[model samples]
Target chain A: MEVEKKQQCSELLQLVIDGQATQQQRHELDEHLPKCECCRNEFELSLSIKEGLKSRLKKPNLPSELATSIQSKVLELA
Target chain B: MSVGESMPYKSKDKQRVFNKEFMPHIDAMYNFAYRLTLDEDDAKDLVQETYLKAFRFINSFEEGTNAKAWLFRILKNSFINNYRKVSKQPNKVDYQEVESYYNSESVDEKITTDLRVETVQHMIGDEITNALNSLDIDFRTVIILCDLEGFTYEEMAKILDIPIGTVRSRLHRARNLLKEKLVNYATSMGYKDKRK
Candidate 1:
């Protein structure tokens, strides 16, 4: 594939991975992926990256005392 | 007129409104602050400052609106204005330098040699977290806002006080930078793709 087409596919893959792709754009990507090995690999990699980010970055547990402290501080300012 | 000062008729009403509206979001606010500051004490202080500001300007907040987003916006602004001011070590990235390097031919060669996702696939949670935390604050902020906190691009724009287009671009760049960091980790682990 040409560099320009490859770049366009890359952008589309990002949109698809981010869940920002329009339905029509998604349909186009779906049609294109099977025909392009490079994009297919890139799409899979992007999916894995998204999954890794979402699952691995655990939310820090808010300390039990923190909530009450914040409440008191906020109320003190009230 | 400072907060908690007796406003006669409005004090009780404001307290009730403030507690009901803002208290529940303390955990979310703290988590966001923690991610941004990457320090427990700073996170706590940031949250305290955010709540104080929220209450101080409670009258400006329209009831029944998005309290969470409003608080997040205030926290973000406070971080920029206050936290960044006091911190001895600032994480400022020169975007022009990064962009020029990324667009250079040598960088293109380096990318082809350096980036391999197959090994990144095998990385564990701690490795991923470290890779993310290693990014510049601006990139990390976008990922934390969009991915971790699940803010929409529009919401992120409002919270970060950037254009929606900027939010999108930053998120894109952030994810790519993270991918690079993970790939570096994979390389250090001595994983090789025989198929390549």
Candidate 2:
């Protein structure tokens, strides 16, 4: 059963990212990552890359004056 | 002429009416305007113009409709009518050409896979802005809607006034193209060097 499970396992790092890996798949991945140094490197690399991309996409600052002006303008109608 | 055809001519008299009705929508309108114009000043003016138009046609608005959706419709029409300028650059990437390369069975069927957000995130980020800027107008809009704004497939079709199938196909192709670009970027950027 374990050998069958191992053969069916996909890349743990990717399945984790895609949100498609099942519980069994995760268990297999956890087991593999400790013995597999290469996968460990992949996990760290993926984390750094994800963080950098997310950081670059910060929401544009809505200037306070602009917000106030827009708010006052909108509220006047009510 | 239709009843709506003669309404816009009356905006001059309805300026105050428009201001009262749409004043509160300025910020959201500005955001949508920016999404369309990609320029802050242009977006502001677009919102202003939309407010004026909505005011003129306020008589046509239903008593209990989605005001935001109506406003966005007006903003979209304004962009289409006003800024349909032609650009001469060709920036196209067709993903169907490379679909043959992916082995469906090889994509690792492991349950709970280990794809980390951090792994491909930066790889995609470096070249994404450039790649997005290069897509044709239609593709760029869809890519931004789904990938950036996270709009659902149905919502996109309604916003673009297109079929759902077109949205799905375009999204699928756009993602693949993005993935291809990011993979290449990762390989070139010391990712592969450390592996070596």
TM-score for each prediction?
0.83, 0.52
Assess the local accuracy of residue B41 in candidate 1 as a C-alpha lDDT between 0 and 100: 86
User: Which lDDT values do the candidates have, in the order given?
Assistant: 0.75, 0.52
The lDDT of model 1 is 0.75
Candidate 1: list runs displaced more than 4 Å: B1-13, B88-91, B96-118
**Ten consecutive residues with minimal summed lDDT in candidate 1 chain A?**
A1-10
Candidates 1 onward: DockQ, in order: 0.50, 0.10
TM accuracy, model 1: 0.83
Compared with the true structure, what per-residue lDDT tens digits does model 1 show for residues B1-196?
1224433338787788778888888888998899878888889888988988888888777666778888999998999888777776446767666555433333222343455556656778888888887887788888887777777777888888878877776676676678778778877877776666
Candidate 1 displacement at residue A24 in angstroms: 1.9
RMSD in Å for all candidates = 4.5, 9.0
Q: What stretches of model 2 exceed 4 Å from their correct place?
A: A1-58, A61-78, B1-28, B86-117, B123-128, B184-189, B193-196
- Which pairs clash in model 1? A78-B4
> Which tens-of-lDDT digit does each residue in B127-150 have in candidate 2?
545545545556666666554544
Residue-level lDDT tens digits of model 2 in A33-59: 788654565555444443443345333
Docking class of 1: medium
lDDT of 1 by residue, A32-78 (tens): 99997667766777677777778766677777787777678766676
